[model samples]
Target: MTGRKLFKSAKFQEVNTAVKKDGAAIFVDKEGQENLIIDNPYAIRYIHSYAEDTPFFLGLADGKLRGTKCGACNYVFATPRGNCQFCGETTKWVDLPLRGKVHTWTTCHFGGEAFLKETPYNLAMIEFEGANSVLLARLKDCKEEEIYVGMPVEARFSPQPQFSITDIWFVPAGAGPGQRSKK
Candidate 1:
């Protein structure tokens, strides 16, 4: 069947049409050749598995940075992996220093809807003192000219805890430990 003739068929009209911003459209057949487009991707229609990073969030609430150490190889992870990337061993909880040096950083010009109000923010890979792993965090309280590689910084927490990574950020070092976000 021709493309136009098949698209105009009664069965095709009943199927949802996935249209893109560029004016491209798609119709899924019974075999599901077309991709499913969700109207509200953020809406929670069902519960999924949760992340195993609860300790990391809890530590932030308690004004502390936490990581995980592999029991077999002693590999430290700032992002708190469930298993060691090297030795395939279970990891244990460990406390990370609040202070660190910026391994690398970038100023974000765009962000998600929740972060649209705070666009042009800074994100950095901070290597905490005495830790081999580098943690990714939002950088704050400094101007664009002030950020640099190997710049010293310390972790800061939001006054109102959200138990998420957003609860913590990094600011220029010597700003004191567990500093609260200015905004």
Candidate 2:
């Protein structure tokens, strides 16, 4: 109440871009008053353990999509899981087909730091042939207007695996339409 304005702007440009260079970002509030926000850059390194999901990440490295199946209920997961949701049984790693249809999709206008550079990208939930669920991934090589439910897509993996989910994505396989998912 004593400092910054209570209202915001469309782009929230508190001040002109040329105002300063000491890690201060400018913003113009709704009242047309310039405001300055401090900005800083930092980085860190940490060890990671895939644990039970090691197979899934490793599968991506091998150009494969690995999902877990409940041996007791036969329920298939598009994303690997350690335990089954329906039967509470241990799941087994299984290979999933690379090609699938887009079950649902959205065009992202905003994203986190990792995807900020690729804002306005398409994301899709792909439905595989035998999987009961869908895999969520970035849809590449296509425009937002070109995306639709049931659109055919195929898995694409990074040539150099980073052992992360970003290692996998999907690209347009062909142009065709299928029925949209109800739910």
RMSD of every candidate to native, in Å, equals 7.5, 7.4
Note the Cα lDDT for every prediction shown.
Answer: 0.76, 0.80
Best-fitting candidate, scored by lDDT: 2
Pairs clashing within candidate 2: 13-27, 13-28, 14-27, 14-28, 15-27
Provide the lowest-lDDT 10-residue window in model 1: 1-10
| Model 1 agreement with the true structure over 35-143: per-residue lDDT tens digits | 3333333455665443687778878989888899998878788878888888888899999988889999999888998788888899999987656689999999887
Clashing residue pairs in all predictions, respectively, total 0, 5
Q: Per-residue error at 119 for model 2, in Å?
A: 2.2
lDDT of 2 by residue, 1-183 (tens): 334333346454433332234445556666787566665557999887999999999999998899999999999999889999898999999999989999999999998988787787788999999999989998887888888998999887887889988788888885333422111
lDDT, residue 157, model 2:
81
If scored against the real structure, what TM-score would every candidate get?
0.71, 0.73
